[model samples]
Each structure stands twice: as structure tokens, then as C-alpha cells.
Target: MTPASPTPPDASRRSRGSIRKTACCLHRGYPVDQLARQCDFLEVAYIMLNGDAPDEASYQTFRETITRHTLVHEQIARMCSGFRRDSHPMALMCALVGALAAFYHDVLDVENPQHRALAATRLLSKMPTIAAMSYKYTIEQPAAYPRNDLSYAGNFLQMLFAIPAEKYVLNPVIEQAMNQILVLHADHGQCASTTTVRAAGSSGANLFACVAAGLASLWGPMHGGANESSMRMLEEIESVDQVPAFLRQAKRDPQAFRRLGFGNSRYRHRDPRADILRETSHRVLAEVGMSDRLLQVAMALEDVALTDPYFVDNGLSPSVDFYTAVILKAMNLPSSMFAVVTAVGRTVGWVAHWNEMHQAPLTIYRPRQIYVGEGYRDYVSRRGERSAELR
Candidate 1:
């Protein structure tokens, strides 16, 4: 796939409007690289949901308010317990998030500005808890509660990794890297998911409904599941030496041995988030000092993909998903959890877009389609098949 050239923004509105511009792979007006380097996810999320950056007092208040809502209702856990233990985390995440609407009725009044803010805060805060708990449900491990003392990413790591009986310390390096990942993915203009949220919100569906609709759209492998597929691809390669053979197969039979995690419909030359995560992935692998062969394979694969003529000719530069798989693997996260983690990062974007849609003159989204079927065919009924006219 050829990468897309940056589309100049509609200057009069100052909005990128879609993923093609994505504010130029930037958020608001702040460059994503700057936000990834300088700001925490919560602060960046604050800036996104609100028009202005928060002052010291406002930021503290915002962070504290969000932290207060991280814990979900007890029944949410009981509901999760009923699912088969083999359930994928992404499926669990989507189901649990949709279930939130039943629990959070007070925040349903989207017309009320206060209610909108509260709804966004609740989703943003509780998403980590929900995502972590979903993973625990799959593993049949006891779910961990949110910790107030930890930063946003630190709390997530603790909830996923910490056992009450065992003292688990939070590592700053890991937490910072995780926060960057979250911030980098917080928004990317519009998508099938974000558009779903917009359409739902236009009809005054509450935050959970809007976000749930969005998440369901994101569940496909071509969308939020790319990182998971990328991880699976690396695992298939197994050893560094096998990467060349895999590439050869990919080049020969592109459809049968598909390539992923490279190229984008957004950036023309490189994915900005990929640039950020490439460096972060290295830092994480070195800091964790893991002998994980998959990371080694990823390193080799990345090198080949960057240099290979086939990839370069197709403008198949590594996208964020490429290194995201590497980073998550280094953190010992399973491939199954990759999309779940993506949902965690994307909740902010979903909420932000939903909020924006409500703020504007709302219009319900109806997809435009071109008919491609055999047109003007006479209705015919055969054996068991009923004609449309009968209905």
C-alpha cells in the first residue's frame, strides 16, 4: 500500500476532520512527538477533552477526579466471571464497556455539559480497570483493584501484574513508556470506530453506547487488531534466520503470506507514532533485558522491512503497530492482550470525538454506498428461498 501524502487542513475550521490529515498526525495543534515526549497521557487527554491545557491546579484536580472513578461496580466483575475463560481480551473489553451504560445512567444526559465531562472522565478512568480485569478473567487470576498512588500507566501495570500478597514495585521506565504509547494513540482523526461513536452520539446515545459502538468497530484485525496480528507474524518467524525466508514468501505470494504492521493510509513516508515507538521499543527491550527470541526476530524483521526494495517501493515503512507489538512483547504481554491494550489507549480518542460531535450541530451519520450487485434483477424464488415481494 502506498502511504498517503498529508492533506492540508481546512484552515477556516482549523480541524483535520478525518484520519487523512489527523491534524497532520498531531493532536489539536500540539505535535504528537512533543506531547509524547513532554506530557503524560492524562494531561494530554485533558488537553484533548478540554479546549485548553490545564493549569497546575486544574491538572491536579482533573487527575484526582479521574483517579476517583477507576474502580467499576462489583457486578461488572461478576458479569465477567460468567464468560468462558478462553474468551479473548478484546471481546471481553467490548462486552464489559458496553455493559457500563447499564451501570452509569447518571452520566447519560449528553446535552448537559457537566454530564458529558463526567461521562468522559468515567470512561477514561475505568477503562484501565475494565481492560485489566478482562485480562485477569481470561487468565482466571484474581482481579486487582486500582491504586491511587500510582500514575495512570503505573496503576494499570500494577492492576495487571500485582498480587496483594506479593509486593510488586512499579518501574518508572516501564510506566513512562506505557504512558507514551497511550498518548501517542489517544486519537488519530476519524475512523470506522470514531465515526460509529459520532453517529451514535448524534442520536443522543450515551457515552458508553457511543464508545461501545466505536470499540465494536475497532475489533477487526485491519483496525485496532493490527498489533496483535503483527505479534503473531513475528512469532511465526520464530528465529532471526527465518525472517529472510518469510520475507521471500511474503514477496512471492503476498496474499497467502501477508505482510502487516508496515505501511499506512495516513502518513506518506513514515508514521509519526512509529518513530516514537521505535525508540521506546529499544529502550524497553534493553531495560527489561529479556532473552525473548521474538523481540530478536522483530529487530531483524524491522531491519529487513526498512531496507527491502519491495517494502520501500510500496512505501511500506513500519507503522506504530510494528514496534507496538515489540514493546508489548517485551513487557511480557501476550498477543491476545494487544488489542485490549489498544482499546485502553483509544478510549480517550473515542470520548473526545464523541464529545466534539455533540458540541457541533449534530447530524446522524448515514453511510453512503454504491450498489455493486447485479442490478435490476427480476425476483425469483427457488425451492426454499422466499422472494423479497413475499416479505
Candidate 2:
């Protein structure tokens, strides 16, 4: 079983909005930025769930444990086959992830600690497999089996791109980019999806169901599609030369062409995650061996945002979303799979938070709200004249 405290691991110094303003609140003693850049995805997840980095021996066992569960049941593969060929990958993922709980329904006693640990491990391992299956199904291709020999991220890439005839020889650059991408997005404190996961988990739902809720939350463009939107914004600018004209329009009518990916409430200055991703963006692009015009446009925008007085004064800097779009584009993944991929990375966090939420006494989350609607009004049926006048 995964090593963890019986109670939810304490956030070292988590303030209400600290993570939104700057770097992640310390996980136990480790800063997440350092973990994202240097460690593998599972290593970072171990830290998040266990409250400390694993020793060499412990990590080996942990790694083996994670890999052992990577393969979803054959029934899941057959189940994925039932989806429409044109279904969105996220839609497919949301459905099948929830379906996974049905197969394991016998042991879903959420109160059992070992059961919770098993559930967490299963989810951390299975989500990528499901995501890859969803992608393959969308493209009318067969799903690839998970490789025990590959690292977590490497296996995911292989499952995603490897075909029957040509085995995917893992490229170091590609694998490194994939690993960092997963690590970088593994967690950001209490985002919409994470909150949804916790809220669902608080209600005594199974892990798969809670995580599926998180997946559904991420399906919306506002949360999960920002990077894709960033790509769109960059594409609209087309060539680097067109950025100036686009900026002029943005300046004249801010609402007409809203600039995305330049800033967020999460970081007042440079997003530390963006800095880490930027360090490797060029390397991945070079490895991709294609001149991506949209990536060029993104960098052009980055340059302007960095030096422009307007952007500087407003604290508008490039964000993690923009760099993600650049790297995923260079890696040649479809926009449809972008959010699905991100959710795969973030499953670690979702699981970690759920584990934490269930540590002590579990309470179904109940948020109080004041009623502001018309009060003590008689029911307005269609027969009423006012009801006939308006909805």
C-alpha cells in the first residue's frame, strides 16, 4: 500500500490564496517547482501523497507498484470500443473513467484505508491508459497496451502514438517533455477540477466517480481549454509580423479580441511553472524538427509581454497554458487531446487531495448560500398572465 498518514497531509503553509498568487504552497518540506523540474511524475506524486520523497529502495517499490496497475481491464478496452468514433477524447475519458468504478464495485468500501489506497493507486495508474484509449478510439485506431518497461510518462506516450507495425522508440527529448509536462501540471492548489474532485469525494463517492466529476469539470473550455484558446489566439495572429496589428485591435477594443495566456490571477509576476516549461519548450520544438509558426507567434507575444510597458505595469506575463500549447503542438498532439492529456497529469493531484480529504472524519461538503430570488411569491403557472408574459 502507498505510504501516507492516516489523516490528510497538512499543507506546510497553505493560505487561502497563496498558490493563486505565486508558487505552490510547500508540500511537506518540498517546493513543487523544484519537484516538477527534476523528478519523475510518480516521484512527485509520491511526495504529494506520502508527504515526503521516497528513498531509493522505497521509490523502486513504489514505481513497480504504479506500473503493475497501468493496464486497465480488458473489459475497459472493449467498453471503449462502444463510443462514437467522433466523440471528443475528454467526453470519452469522462465516461470510461466513471465506468471503471463499476468493475471494482465489490470492494468500494470507501471507509477502508487499504481500499482507499488501492483505489488511489488504480486511478493514478489507469487514467493515462484510459486517456490513450480514448484518443485511439477517436482516431479509429486500436488501443496500444501499456509497457511495464517504460516510465510513467514514457508508457503514456507509447500507448498514445505507438502503432502495431512500428513500435514507438522513445525519444529522450519527447519523453523528457512529457515527464515535465505531467509533473508541472500534477497539481495546482484547489483549481476548479481539484475542488470538484474534493467536493465529490467529500460526499462519500468512490474515487473513480469523484475523479470523473473532476474530468467533467475540466471538460469546460474556461478551465481546461485555455491553452487551446491560447493556441487559437496565436494562430489568429498568424505570422510574427501580424502580432502588432492584433495587439492594436486588442488595445482598441479589449473585449473584441481578449488576450489569453498572457496573465492570470494565479501569478502576479512570472508564473514559476511557466519559467520551468519555457526552459524546455525550445528543446522540444527543435526535437519535433518542424518550424511551428504558431509557436513562433507565441514567442513573439512573449517578447512583447516581457518588454512592453503596458504589459509590465499590468503584471501580464506569459503563463503555463501558453507554453503547454506550444509544447503539445510541437509534439503534434491534437487540440482535442490537450485537455485530456492535462487531466491525466493532474490525476495525481486529484487522488492526493481525495486521499487527504478522507483521512479524518469524512463529511459531505455542504456550502451555505443565501437565497436571493423572489421570495414568498405565488407559483406562476403558464395560465397566469405574468407567466404568459415572461419565462
Candidate 3:
């Protein structure tokens, strides 16, 4: 008998996993880990914006351009004042970014490459300033102006933690940790917020508006707020002795336990970003002399979870959000500001996605939805006769 002919591959199923499979950054074809280790956030942003690492002259020019834009428009400061003192930073950030379109209408043209570039630069440079302002506004502290003399991360630290009399000294170890956090979060291809940016940009909206939409999406607990939730969970555990009980509860009713940041959607074994952050968290905690009982609890919990067959079978590994919570807490950031920091780091990614979508052959994004409801029904007007029938 003749051998059976080979069956052709299914075209419909071929692209099912393509989105996750192709998610990556190819800055000069370097792996993301290499980029995160070798470059600062400014250098990473340069690569994202210009598609390559900059030479000396180009690096100076780019750095200067970013530094010049670091100071937000004064009108933006006034707009931030409108928010209530108790407002969430993420909510304030979402509103402020949307308001940027009104303040910067002069550069709102997506079709003009120069306008797009300008918007990207302004958003990338000023996000930290905006985020810090939101934090200051909540505490009724005067906003600190951006100091161009500091590095990007240093400037943000100064703005965030500075006060009236004392001069804020930037610690080298904390600055390095902050840079690593920013670079690690700078981009993750087509994540929820990035997709939101692309979808809004597809409608030819202004760049700031597109990013505002992305910010709104990022505010969801499942996306950018995971670290905040993780930090809260660790606090609830309270100590290493309590970790086993929490794990038992988690295993009993997963919904009740609500494991906030254990596993990632993309990485089954380990998130590469988590590896860098885990080490950084230890180093920063050691250098900063911050006592974090939660970090100890988290480590114990991770040990318990990893050894369990249930967690192992389900691919439950610590993700970027897990270690990030510890690091940010060690840095003295409140849990509420955790997501805002993520938003600040991710602004460059959102702008880059918006720019890329506009530069391509543009098409409005409209996804098809399955109709699961009743197909058709007779129109019934709420008139006298219908009212009598209902009665």
C-alpha cells in the first residue's frame, strides 16, 4: 500500500498564538535582558524612539532634548490642582494626560512626523513629573520642579521625595535600581495598555489622548495595579509564620486567596524581568537599610508555593510584579503609587506604539463580536395600548 499523504497545516489555527510568540524588542537586535542590564532608562527610551542606540553626539542631543521637556507646562500644574486631595494617582494621571491634548494642541497632528516626534519626546520626558505632581497634590505638598542637572531617574527621585529645606541627595544604589525598574518596564510588546494606545491611535486621535486611553486601561487591577495588590497581600500575610496559612487558604479557595502577582500570562517558568528585579530588590533593601518584613514573608511564601505540586503544575512562578512590590516599598513608595510608577515607566512604550500605528497603513480597529442574544424581536412601543397590556 502507498504511504498516506501528509495533511496540510491549518491556516486558521496558525495565527492563534502569533501575538504572544512575536512579542519582543529588537533594539539593534539585542535581547531585552542585555538592554536592561547595559543601558539606562534614557538610553533605552532613545532606542525605543529612534530604533537604535545613540552615538556620543546623538546621545547628548537626545538627553538634552528630554531634559528641556522635563518641566511640564504650568497650565498642567493648575489642572492638577483641580483634583481632590484624596484622589488616586492613577485617576489623576489618566485625567492629566487627557488634558495634555488640550494644552498642547499645537502638536496634535498625527500625520506630521515632526509633530509625532515632539509629542513622544514631551510625553516621555514629562511623565515622571506628572506622576510626582499627583503624589504631591495628594499630600498637599508643593510640587518640586524638575532639575535638569540630575539624570532622568535622579530627577524623578528628587521630585518625588524632596522637601522645602533639605536638599535631596540621590543615592547611587537607589538610582541604579530605579533605572533598572524603568528599563524593565519601558516596553512589553502589545500588552493591554499598549494595545489600548494602538487602538485609540488607529482612530486618528491625538497622541496624548491615545496615551490617556492607555492609562485608563492600565489602571485596571489585572494590568498595572498588580504590584500594588501584591504589596497589600504581603502586608496581610504580616510575617513568615503566616505565609503557610495564606498558602493553605490560597490552595483551598483560590478566589478567596487572590494570589495577586504569582504567575504571569507570558512566562511559564520565570519572567526575565523578575530575575533582574529580584536581585535589585535584595540589593536596594540592603543598601537602603529599610526593614521589610513583607519581603521576608514574600520570600517564604514563594518557597512554599514553588515546592507545592499544585503550583508547579499550574506554572506559578514569581513575576515582575512580585519583586517590584518589595523594591518599591523598600524605596518608600506607598502602595497606591505603585501603579503610577509603572505608568511613568511605560509612557515611552505607549508613545512609541501610538507613533508606530500612525506611521503604518492606518485602519480603524473594530473587532467582531459573537451575537449570543436573541436575534430579532417585534418593536413594541411604550404607548397606551402597550401600557394596558403590561398592566
Model 3 agreement with the true structure over 38-66: per-residue lDDT tens digits = 88788888877767778989999999999
lDDT of 1 by residue, 1-391 (tens): 3444498522221333224343256677777888899999889888888756789999999999999999999999999977899998878888889898899888888889998888888899999999999888888789999989988988999998888689889888789889988888788876767767777877778999888888888878888888888988887886898988888877875543333787776666777788889899889988998588988898888898789888777667678888888888888889888878888888988887777776555656555566677867656677545576667
TM-score per model over all chains: 0.90, 0.90, 0.89
Taking all chains together, the TM-score of candidate 2 against the true structure is 0.90
- The residue-level lDDT of candidate 2 at 11 comes to 42
Query: Rank order by lDDT, top first?
Result: 1, 2, 3
Please list the residue runs of candidate 1 whose C-alpha ends up more than 4 Å from where it truly belongs after superposition. 1-24, 253-259, 374-391
Which digits, one per residue and each the tens of the lDDT, describe model 2 over residues 1-391?
A: 3444478534421212114435543544566577777899889888878878899998999999999998888998898768789999998899899998998886478889999999888889898899999999989888999999999999999999999998689998989888988987887788899889888987789999999999999877777777777777877786999988877666665433333666666666777888788877878877776467887887788788778887666666677887888888888888788899899988988888888876667766665566687856646666665654665
Q: Can you list the residue pairs that collide in candidate 1?
A: none
Candidate achieving higher lDDT, 1 or 3: 1
Top lDDT model? 1
lDDT of 3 at 302: 69
Pairwise TM-score winner, candidates 1 and 3: 1
Alpha-carbon local distance difference test for all models: 0.82, 0.80, 0.80
